[model samples]
Target: MSNVSVCFSWQIFTMESCVLIILVAMPGVWGGAWGVTFGDLCALKGTSVVMNCSYDYPSGYSVTNVGWSRPHYAAASGKWRLFFLSRLPTPPVHFEYVGDYNGNCNLKIHDVQRTDEGNYYFSFVTTLDRYTSTTPARLSVKELTAIVRPSTVAEGDDVSLTCVLGCPARTAVVWFRDGQRVLKPVFQARREDAGRYYCAVLGQETVRSASVVLNVQYAPKNVTLSVSPPRGVVQGSSVAFACASDANPPVTPTAYSLYKDGQFVSAGQSHTVLGVQPSHSGLYRCQAWNNVSWRGVDLMNSTEIRLDVQYGPTYISVSLEPQHAVEGSRVNLTCSAVANPAADNYTWWHKRTDSASSSPGPMLWAGSGRVLTLPAVEASHAGLYVCRARNSVGEMSSAEMLLTMSRGKRGSQPHLIIAGVGGFLSVTLVIALLWYRKQRTHAERKPAVFGSGLGVRGSSSPATGDQLDAVYANVGTSQWSPPLATAAQDAASRSQRSARHEHELPTSDEAEVTYSTVTIQPRNPSFPPRTNNSRAPQKCGIQCLTLMAVDIHGRKRDTLV
Candidate 1:
C-alpha cells in the first residue's frame, strides 16, 4: 500500500519501509503516453451518485495506486485533497471507492449536498510515474425547480414554463402536471391547465422540483337562464329564474342581472316573481360578467325566453248543426271558446221544455275536446242546451241554444187522420158501385115491350090504340066545375093520373083488342077538331098521354087525350 502526502516537505512512506511522498502536478510530472477520459455528470441533492473515470499510463510499468478528488482550490495554489482513494482501506465520510485500483477510479458519494457541486479529478501512480487528469470530469449537483411565468395569468394568454437546475448541465428538462407529463413547455394557458406542476432532470427523473400552481383567470362564458315553471305560467303564480355562467372563478351573484324585454328587472343569481300578472309576461334574459375584461366588453348574455301569461277560457259559445233539429235524427252540438291556455275540458247540460228555471238541468255528457254528439234526436231532446269549458286558467259557460223539432214532423197526427178519412171514402164509393151494378143486372134481365099493344105500368107489353082510348080520360075539360086555381091543379093532377092509368095492365079482353076491330076514333065535338100541324101542350115535368075511343055511333066521338 502507498500514500500521498500533502506537501513537498513531507516524507515518503512505503508499504514495508513506511515511506510517504507528496504528489503534485508539475511541468514534467506526467509519464509518457499519459491521457484521461471522462464525461460530464448531473447529480441531484440528497441522493447518491458515481463519477466514473479512466486513465492511460506507461504500458510497461506496473500499476500501484488510484484515487478520486474534487478540485476545491485554484489551479495556481497547488493545494488538493483526496476524498476517496482506492489504495486506502476505508474512505472519508460520505465518500466511498467501489472501483479497481489497478485502472478504474470510480468514486461514489452518498447523501450528496448542494455544496458538493464542482469538477472531479482522477489520479494513478505507476512504478515509473504518477499521473493526474488535466481535464477533470465536471459534476453538477442540481435542485430541479419549475418556473412559471406570470404566476397569475389570464386564460387564453400565452405563457412560458421552464425546468431550471441550480447548476449548468447538458441534460434535458421534462415537465409534469399533477402526476402526468405536460406535453408542451410553452403554450397558451387554459382553465384546465391549473393543477400542480413540477419538473425533473433527464437522469434524475425521480428527483422532481417543487410544485407550482397556475392560476388562470378568465371572463364569464356560456351564460344561461332557466325557469322554475316551464309551462302554464299564469296569473297568481310564483316563478323563479336562475342564471348560470361558465367561468374559471365562480361568477358572483353581483355579476348577474335579469332583464325583461330589454329592461333591467332584477339582480343577483336568481329573480323571483311572486303572484305574477300579465305585466310580468315578456321576453327575459340574464347577463353575467367578471373582472377579467373591460366594462360592457366581455359581458355574456343568455338566450331570450318568451313568457306568456294565461288568463281564462273566455267567451265560450255553443253551436248546433241544423239549428232546428228533427226527432229521431242525429244532431251535433259543438262547444268552443277562446282562452290563453286552450280549453282542456268540456261539459254539456240539457233543460227540458217543461222546466221553469232559466238555468239548465242535469249534465248530459262530459268530454275532453270541443264537440259533443247526440246519436238520435228526439222530442225530449228539444230544449235549451248549455256548454261549459274549463282550462288551467279558468272556467266559462256558453250561451244557451234552443233545440226544437221540425214543424212538418210535429203534425203527424193530422196526417194520420187525413189518411184514415181517405181510406173511408174509398170504401163507401166501392159499396155504392156494387149496389149500382146489381140494379143494372136486374134491369137487363127484364123483357122488352113492343109498341101499340096495350098501355100498362110495369107491364111486359105496350098498349094498343083502342085500349089507350078506354083507359085514358080528358083532363082539359070545358065544363065549369070549380075555381081557376083549383081547376088548374085538378087538371094537372088528372093529366098525370091519366098518363099513369094508360100504363096499367088490362084483362084478357082488353089485351086481345086490335085496331082493325075498333070503330073510327074521333075528337070531342064540342072542341074543334085537331089539325096535323098543331103542337101538343107542354106540362112542367109530366108526360102527356093522348087517348082516342070509338063510340057505338056512326059519328066519331072524342074523349080526354
Candidate 2:
C-alpha cells in the first residue's frame, strides 16, 4: 500500500462567535483528502442535527465500507474505548448514515436528546487500507429555558423576561403568557400581567421553555361591606357585617375593620352585633388592607352605608296648646313620642272629672290623630286626658293630664236685684211730687171756705152729716192723700157746728142745706202760688155740691148749686 496523508477543515457558528477547526493527518499519509465537517456543533433538544463529512484515498483504492463511532467506557480494559455506532446489533432509530461508501460520510440525528451529546468520528475501509478522522466533532444538546429578572414584583414596576439556550445561534424568540402570545418581553407589571409565562425559538414551535409564574402585588381594591339582614332590622335583633376586597395578598381576617358614623367600632372580616337598638342606627362603612401598598397607602375603604334599626314608640307624652281650658274657649291636645320609625297612629282618651264623684270616670275614646282640637270647650269637656302613640312595633300611653273648665261670662243675681230696686224708688218719687203740686193748685182756687155745716146754696140740701160721715168712712185711710187727711179733720170740726145749729134752730120750719169741708194743704216750695182767677166755680176743686128743703107737713124738696 502507498503512503497517504489526510487533512480536514471546518467552521462552527455560535451565538457569541464563530470557530474554525483543521485536522492534520499523519506525515506518511500524503495526497489523502477528507471533506470538511462541522466542529463542536450545538443543537436544541427535540430538534435535528446534520454532520457533513467525506473522504478521498489513492485513486486506485476502491471503497469498501463506511460508518460512525462514539467514545464509550470499556469495563474490561478499565479505559475508554470506541464503540462503532453502525456495528451495534440494533442501531438507534434516531441516527441515520446518509453518506455512501463513495466518500460521502455525512451523518444525521433526529429528535436530539441530552444523552446523544458526545464526540463523533467517521471511518472508511477500502481494498488496500482503512482510515478514520483523528479530530472528532462534538455534539452539544441544549434545552430552551425561560429566565425572569424578578419573579415577584409590585404592580406598575418594570419586568424583564428572556428565553435562554446553551447553544450559540442567533434565532428569533417568541414570548407567551398563559398560552397567549406577547409582543414584548419587557413591560410594566400590572394586575393582569400575573400569570404563567414561557418562550420558544421563532421557527421551533415544539421547542418551548418551562413555564414561569409571575406574581403582581398591589393594594386592596373593590372593597365592599355587606349586611346579612339588609332590611327590617328591629331592636333586640342580631345583625352581621361582612367585609371583602380583591388583592394580590388577600386581606387577613384581622385586617378588616368596621366603622359607624365615621367612628371605629371593631376589627375582623365579619363583625356581629347582638341586641341592636335605635341608638345603633347610623352611617356605616368597612375597611380592608394587606401587605401590598399603593399610592403611599396600604389600606382601602368601602362606600358608606346606612344601618337603620327599627323600634316602637318611646317617651310618649301629650302637650296642651292653651294651658288653661275654659268654657267656650278653643283647646288643643298634641301627642308626641320618640321612636326609630315615627309613630303613625295617635289616640286620645278622656276621663271626665266633672261628675259628682271625686274619682275620675271611665276612660272613653276622645279623638284620633296627633292633635285633638276642641273648637268650643265646655263643662262636659273637663276631664283627665291621656294620649297613646302607636307604631308597627308597639304602642305607649302618656300620663294622664287633668283639665278643668271655668264658667263663661254672665251677670250675677245680686247685681240685677240692686238695679231693679233703684229703678222702682225713682218712679215712686216722681209720682208723689206731681200729685202734691196738683193738690196745692186746687186748694188755692177754693180758698178754703170756712163754712162749717151743710149749707143750702141753691135750694138744695147738702148731704147730711151722717151721710157725709158714711162717705168719709168709705175713703180708706191707707189710700188717703196728704190733702184728704186735712179735709177729714175739717169735716169733724164742721159736724160739731152742725149739731149746735140743729139744737138752736126750730123744727117746724125745716130747711135743706148743702155743706162741704174744703181743706188746703201748704204748697211745696218747689211750686209757685196759684191765682184766684184760676179757681173759678167752674173749676171748683170740690167734685160736686147739692142742697134740699122740707115743708111743715113732712114734705121734701131737692136743689142743685
**For this target, which candidate reaches the highest lDDT against the unseen true structure?**
2
List, residue by residue over 202-231, the lDDT tens digit for candidate 1: 666777788998888887878899998987
Per-candidate RMSD vs. true structure?
15.3, 16.2
For residue 367, model 1's alpha carbon misses the true position, in angstroms, by 8.2
Q: Which portions of model 2 show Cα errors greater than 4 Å?
A: 1-38, 48-111, 119-137, 289-292, 350-364, 378-382, 410-561
lDDT of 2 by residue, 197-276 (tens): 98887887777888999999889999999987998899999999999999988899899999999899999999899999
| Candidate 2 lDDT (Cα, 0 to 1) | 0.71
Model 1 whole-model lDDT (C-alpha atoms): 0.66
Clashes of each: 18, 16
Q: Quote the RMSD, in angstroms, for model 1.
A: 15.3
